[model samples]
Target chain A: MNKREELLTEKQIRRRTFIAFTFLFLFLGSAILGWQWLHRQPTDHGAIQPLRKVLDANEFIFSSLFSKKHFAKTYSKDLPLPHPRVNGKIGLNSAFDTATWKLHLVKAPGDTLLIGIDEIKALPKTEIIFDFKCIEGWSQVTHWGGVRFSDFVKKYGLDEQSKMMFAGLSTPDDEYYVGIDTKSMMHPQTILCYEMNGKPLPLNQGYPLRLIIPVKYGIKHLKRIGTISFSNYRPPDYWYERGYDYYSGL
Target chain B: MKKVIHKHPLAIRWLHWLNFPILTIMIWSGLLIYWANDVYRLGWGDRTVLKFFPGSFNKALNIPFRLAEGMSIHFVFMWLFAINGVIYFLYLVFSGEWKFIAPNRNSLKESWLVILHDLRIKRGLPPQKKYNAAQRIAYTAVIIMGLGMLLTGLAIYKPVQLNWLCAMFGGYEWARAEHFTITILLVLFFLIHIIQVIFAGWNNFRAMVTGFETENIDAKTETAMPTEPINTKSETDEQA
Candidate 1:
């Protein structure tokens, strides 16, 4: 009887040992797999269709909840943005032709009005320094001088109840574009920036006009403004469709 | 008479110890992320209540305002934390260790009795086994929570890449909040686990560290006991 008990115990012990070694092997195997996955450079620019689909669905669901009023309260203003970095050279190619530039306003379908840079200059110009956050984990403090979006709206009589959203200025070539919600457009810091860091807006920084909002990441501040539109329908955003949050607010 | 017996295996011992430092680093790095967005709290509008980390807590930790450093450390250490967790879980599953750790239908009732015994309200001592009902419940619950943390952590980390996971966890922000709360729960569990280990004393503790325990052989029980006796072959096989 004692011998039988001993044999059974021994069998159990052997099983445990086998299990332990198997687990160790599996651990090494998983680690190797993980390392391979991590080091593999992104081969497909738009590869992994299933993963992208999952990501898109997740973005839609997340944005819906994130834009909820209750959650927005957690988006605090305490964390300051760092020095803005240069990224995404879209439409700014040659020197900005300030002479030929016209800030086109599309109030309604087929109702487009063109305003020159001189006209924008006629509005009340304001300057302020604030951090410019980026979609990537970086930011920078920058000085911007331009007419406030609110001032521009008021001057053109565009701040009407019917106008629910605002679009930013970019080159005639639709390489770069930004769309902002109504609340962000009226923000005191939102500007049609004409100068940066005490000088006229650099050629690379959108010479004639650009949009700058302290409360948003730099993506929303479209450079080289060519056309501005106000609309009830959501405007086409350059980054939103690319998995970034539509309301890219700070 | 009570006799000393081994409870935790050597693999478990190493896994348990490894989790200590790895989880600590994870939590510390998570704190850095949380500090940047420390907006969560438990209270209604108007009257003030408890804050997450009062000024005193920050002062006590002396955590510097270094976001870059925080991010670097977090990204680097996350690999170790995640790998260790995955290995631990797989080990349990592959080794049939889940059988012992997982709670059964009788677990709830047994857990109440165990609790009552611990509180000194019950007359008789609890059943002697590798793990009591309370231990099983706590252990199983923590494992489940660990899985939860992983899910929520991934949801927040790659919200754009894994948007569906993010949505399932409520959202990116909610996942972050849930991850923080789970860390708090883990810390609480750690405290209780440590206290329990200490209360169990040297034999219990030594068994974990050394993978063996010295026990006085009861001659009568050895002869009369119906179960198989623990022998050298079983010990060696189990130890392996």
Candidate 2:
């Protein structure tokens, strides 16, 4: 006695159900095929081209909406890492001379500028405590003393070159590298870190100078500065070449 | 006399079916991502009853060293999951099908009886129009959980960019915990749903796919319906 009931025959129900199930199988079959196809595509810089496209699109959206006002929340200095953890030793493994370590800046294809740790420290020192998040799914509260990258750009008179699409950095041995977009580079929280806790950076934790962009995962916080360069296009990144998102924003 | 009833609309059936695979992929890929920080466990503080996942489980599932692959899949397939969910919600609202899906005041009370009946502690089912009370509650709860998954996923995904949203969910770590917990709940829901469907018998299950359910009328009832039209929807669809 239900409203909208109909007196269809058994054959009609059977026919309809058969058709419905056929369509269901077709959809599922196609879904499986699509998945296989996506994976089978040739890898483009360690990721499938389509997947990389999506990651790039994600970068576009996040960077487009990026604001300098938003800062990674600073925590109390008391909660700093008692036992610092380093996930990788790519660039830090090589023997290096801290005394001769001058940050090489390639302003253009030809123009190069050299800066020392004291020059970086001379601009202004800012102390910040924040959670340093790792892409491998762990986070620790850390205290870093550094010069705000914004001030460094201003002091070095690179205000014009700072607008480039990306700022690429490499370790002294050219092992670990990262390509950070200009917008994130100019964030108020972005700093060229020199001190960890209350003392000079430990040898393992990029002593002397390192990039500390809190707006990104720990991977983007390249340790042991060696060279810096800007380009209109995105520069090479170690993690990005291994299928990680280029933006890697927080 | 045998008769057929229009239980589900074509649109509802299509959307419902789409959700099955979409949700499966979302959960499977989510498991891949959560494997990185699989810290949740049953017992707390020193003594442990059950770990969320043992190393053996991870090995069996091939979940190790796949963070990059897991992330790429999760990020890419998220669009399909979100779009399907949004369309399903809109369709339910616009078609007035939500009436059958939404829980009523007596749902909690009746769902308990439904559970008892299924357990053989009771006899007759609560009078069901479209969905049983247990089904109403379970279905509604799942939709709410799906929405929770979306919001929590976004919060952890862009904590700095969407700081306000992340703060609303009690910050990064808490939001991740919430997201993982809801996933476990969804898995539970999926298991129970599959068991119920199989136990309900083939006739009832077929209705979902074909949009029609078969009903039987006794000879006396059939004979008494002489003055009425054979078709029910002919009048109901056009209104009284």
Candidate 3:
């Protein structure tokens, strides 16, 4: 071997080390900047709102690009019982009169309809047994029986004139609220649920009504729906405000 | 005579270093998400051998009530992670670096020998090229695990839309479990990789960063004695 091939020249080593360090410093600098960008509180959601916006944008793109007709996996009716766990109790904390409580809905500006439980039951009942996924990483195959939200919307002539972008639901005390995309709201599996496991909903299970959305995490399945409103803009969501995704889709 | 030989290419070095932080963040954020439902255990039924994590482990790490933040970070960084991985894989293919990375026909047998050598049960390591048999197998397996994580992640992320994928993995819950298991496996691979790098010494570690290593010219010429450590002096004694 030639003597020249025996070693890296002093200058060559220096140059390489300098170049490597430069790259390292550049990477570190970019990473710090990227971290700052991700943690920047651009919105009121939290310190990570900028990152949250990216996630929301992902949800938006997925929702817009994909057809909502895709059905969640449904199990055979003969399958074993599903024990639905009570995940959240934010809206269900308050005491309310079940008899006087009606589903207050806003079809359009200044157009309102107060739907009683009997009216909700009058719509064609849909019973689906599907996996109910929670954001917490657990899932249950729960059987839900109720009128499809789309059917109810159609029968009431809601969204007939103007297709709203979102469906907003709130608790009676308005402590908790969720805004769902109209497409997901009108999905065939989405229902204004009144029964669970072949029986009327227990008080803890949202009693009169709750939203049974198979295509969404349990968080979006707003319980004890007090008010239903259609909106062009995305309504404030309890969890979204608390730093969860606005879509909360499956 | 000493020779400064190219070890890792510039692109490979960059990708490797970039993946360090990216995978670290992925694992950290993944841990935050997993804390929500840390239900995995080592035993069947009620006879618990060990849990995925103890409550104290979570408390020590402050891994609580961060699901929303974790999900946001995960979804945002996942794009970067996937993109970097894709670019790295393409670079490996186009640059023909896969020759060093992909496990070949002799890898299984050689990997066992390498393992025995590592465990001090065998006298010496198997002869190697750019990467040893064990490294080739591990690196390839980690890449496959990355792909598995991506697929399983998508299945669980969009179970309804990606119903076929969910079904392929047995179900949505199974997909989540698979994803978590892969994450844990990647973590284990990372620990072992770091340990091996440390054991391999500075010349090997620096090659991953600076893309070159000083080796004895005689060592390069002698294919018969592959495992012999090159004794070569360089101008940069710090790297020696």
**Candidates arranged by lDDT, highest first:** 2, 3, 1
TM-score of chain B of each: 0.85, 0.91, 0.88
Top-scoring candidate (DockQ): 2
Q: Write the per-residue lDDT of candidate 1 for residues A49-112, one digit (tens) a residue.
A: 3333434454355445432122111222344534346676788765556778887787666888
Question: Model 1 Cα displacement at A70 (Å)?
Answer: 25
Q: Give the Cα-based TM-score of candidate 2 against the true structure.
A: 0.94
Which stretch of 10 consecutive residues in model 3 chain A shows the poorest summed lDDT?
A1-10
Predictions' DockQ, in order: 0.06, 0.59, 0.40
Docking class of 3: acceptable
Relative to the unseen true structure, what is the C-alpha lDDT of residue B70 in candidate 3, on a scale of 0 to 100?
Answer: 87
User: What DockQ would you assign to candidate 1?
Assistant: 0.06
Report the C-alpha displacement of residue B120, candidate 3, in angstroms: 2.4
Model 2 steric clash pairs? none
Candidate 1 chain B lowest-lDDT run of ten: B66-75
